[model samples]
Target: MRSNASDCDVLIVGAGIAGISMAAHLQDKCANLSFMMVERRAQPGGTWDLFRYPGVRSDSDMQTLGFAFEPWDDDQSIAPGGSILEYLRGVIHKRGIADHIRTSTTVISADWQGDQACWLVSVEGPDGPEKVRARWLYMSTGYYDYDHPYDAQITGLESFAGTLVHPQFWPENLDYADKRVVVIGSGATAVTLVPAMAEQAGHVTMLQRTPTWMSVGPSRDRLARVLRRILPRKLAYWLVRQRNIRLFDFLYHAARRNPHMAAEKLSEGVRKELGDLYSPEDFTPPYNPWEQRLCLVPDSDLFKSIRQGKASIVTAKIDTVQTDGIALEGGEVLPADIIVTATGLKLSLGGHIKVSIEGRPVNWGEEFFYRGCMISNVPNLTFVFGYLNASFTLRADNTAAYSCRVLNHLRTSGTQIAIARPPADGLVEGEPFPFSSGYLMRDLAQVPKSTDALPWRLNHDYLADCRDFRRNGVDDGHLQFELAPRVTDQSPVADQPEMA
Candidate 1:
């Protein structure tokens, strides 16, 4: 298609936070080894770049959302999409990781060649299909797919006359100002959108099938700003990062351990903030605060919007979509000039990419999740999965660090392929990993279910898992030190070669 497909020491898929962090860690630790990162998008910053909806901000604070090596310098704790994208771009440029990334290159399929002890990767690019062989394949493709949208089939959605938009594919030019906007869904996207659009929209209605626990905090951290002004930039960054980490950890742990008390406190807090304007019955979720993610309402902005009569909450199931508005199942029709589906996304493991070993298909559904990083039978592959309790980046950083350790171990032991095996006593099968219904139920038909071994377990207790993963090889057990002949070294390639 273009030129001869070149080989690499490691092949990384996805140029998102996970892939970028992995590449950075590998480059910093193993400078002698050459690796290439393949990203399907034209640029980096996967989710941040893709979702450009109004009021789209990180659910986690910016300090924690950012890479460990890079600290977010923005004044706001909950940074917007544009700021996060810029920060990621800055990190890539600062680290010079752009050189190692092959943009607009998609890995179609990967097959492990047992005899050669290498992975044969077939990729599609702008020019044509190309193939490469790598001793190690690291699937840093984030859990969710870029183009997939979770749109529930509404009965009369097609018949609606007004513009209907999904937060996933928000139109850049659509004007919400002076329009009676109705946002559907009760997740983070809807929470964020309702408040933001309410500021300008003629009237904004938050239409929710179910309520989600929403908590309010100051968008700008005053202490963080003060420290930034007084202390050195690096020191300020470290202090704020540590403080937020501890705070979030405590909150999440409390909620998980004492659900009843936590739920009461969260509900009381919301009631006090919104007073009579926010109906506790309609706004408060039945589940515990952290059972599902607690929606962050910066500075009680959403409540303020409600107080000002700019926004209203409507909890009802949509029976049908009328040409002028949405009809509730209870026979009430609400008028709206525009409808925004702030619905969640489809959960796809490894971007729905195909994986096979020695010509046999690897059924991910049947596979075990080993330490939430590697698949049971998947050899020489490590994925980037973050903590469910704390900020995802914190866990991602730990994953990157542990991956480095694993790589070093492999190099020292002359192990070309290492696969993690479940416990012999079958403890892995007995204790399936716990996950939220959103992920488990949303894509049940598509993704594999977590069995006892190699199950999808999210470690909310951040430090414990971080220490365990970093020090311990694998939680249950790992098939370590599978030796193979080394690949023949080719000519040293230039760092910044143009992508074919």
Candidate 2:
């Protein structure tokens, strides 16, 4: 048992993109606030560090994916995982916030005391089990669990003779040279793995239960490059970012409003790129576009692999896994030296940290999301949840800026705690995410929901979110503020060993 002398006004969980962005935004706008960042992983890069699979890259362009305060001056707009990790490390060093971070520190639980107006955060640090006090709590932990991934649960998987791998935990010494690989699922991971492994492998087959819509574009943004040559750096970056945002909005609206026309346009584009090798039925998905995330392939690499006969796509159901390969329901067997499962991620909230308010555990599922940042009836705590439609950083940036505003308001009003309250009229119920991604659907019940009312419904549209989070004031009737009640210091935490 150790006492933490370095108390903080705010204790932030996870030192990833969202956490770093939050720190930067607060520093630029609210430098006086004392905050500390804690990460369970030894490194700062979140997804970028975790995923080391072949051809791992961002689905969204770097112009939007990169922090708003920092310009992404990289050569490729669809950056590789290594480059993104490097960029995140550079930001932490450049900002001089490295010392403020405690790596390999996992938060086990947080208990909010209304009387003291502080949260007793139980964390496992390098030394041992420790207790830290913070006036407020901020969660930058991403939606997915780092320690566990979703299990596909295929029958007789252990009987397979081939090497089994998941993209979430790619082996460091993995070699695929001259190997016949079969990748399961048709999402972004499968598309990326197929093209990349095809380069060295004897052949690669993509087996999917259902096809996903894919879009191919140049890895480098030619317009951004041209603009940089003619205009100032800041101006060029702004223009490029805005252009991509508008284009994403237009395409999403088109897909939602006119599914048939949108499908026709997407199919025509893919058909022209692949020529006779592509079939509309095989490439087309049953659901409308944007129903699930659209996979992006850089420079038609996937199509190139298929055209060269290095890779092929098969839609089938797995009856069982044989010693040699997977047997299909349609009486076909796929022979493979290796099998990769790119199924999906397992969603986690607040890094699975248990939260209690005055001895009662928080029911996150029953709570309403207030501005997609703070949970309803939860005091002085905020979680950063991004937009699924646009680049995640866009919403992350907005959430950070909005949080800064709320913090400033609290300071001005001399309030130690603030909670989101339901209005006199009840909120209309709706799904947490408008989209139907498998991961989202599987964990929808556990997540917090938003309503149709203002400051409650999280519209994925970037422009609307920007206006609401940035321009709108925080003193709306939804958030109820209060000062702390007079109380003595908190009791000592129980003596326990640090989590191994």
In terms of lDDT, the best-performing candidate is 2
lDDT of 1 by residue, 419-451 (tens): 876557643333332436475467655543345
Off by over 4 Å in 1: 1-4, 425-427, 430-435, 445-458, 473-477, 485-500
Q: After superposition, how far is residue 440 of candidate 1 from its true place, in Å?
A: 2.8
Candidates in order have lDDT scores of: 0.77, 0.86
Any runs in candidate 2 off by more than 4 Å, and if so which? 487-500
For 1-500, candidate 2 gives per-residue lDDT tens digits of 77665578888888888999988987898888888999989888888988999999998999999998888888799999899999999999999879789998999999997777788889998888888988878899988888898888999889989899999999998999999899998999999999999999999999998899988889999989999899988889999999999999999988999988888888888998889888776689989888888889899999999999999999888999888899999999999899998888888888899999987899888888988789988998999877888898987888888788878887777666778987877777775676888888888777887887668875778888777765668888789876665522452211211011
- lDDT, candidate 2, at 62: 95
Clash number by candidate, in order: 7, 0
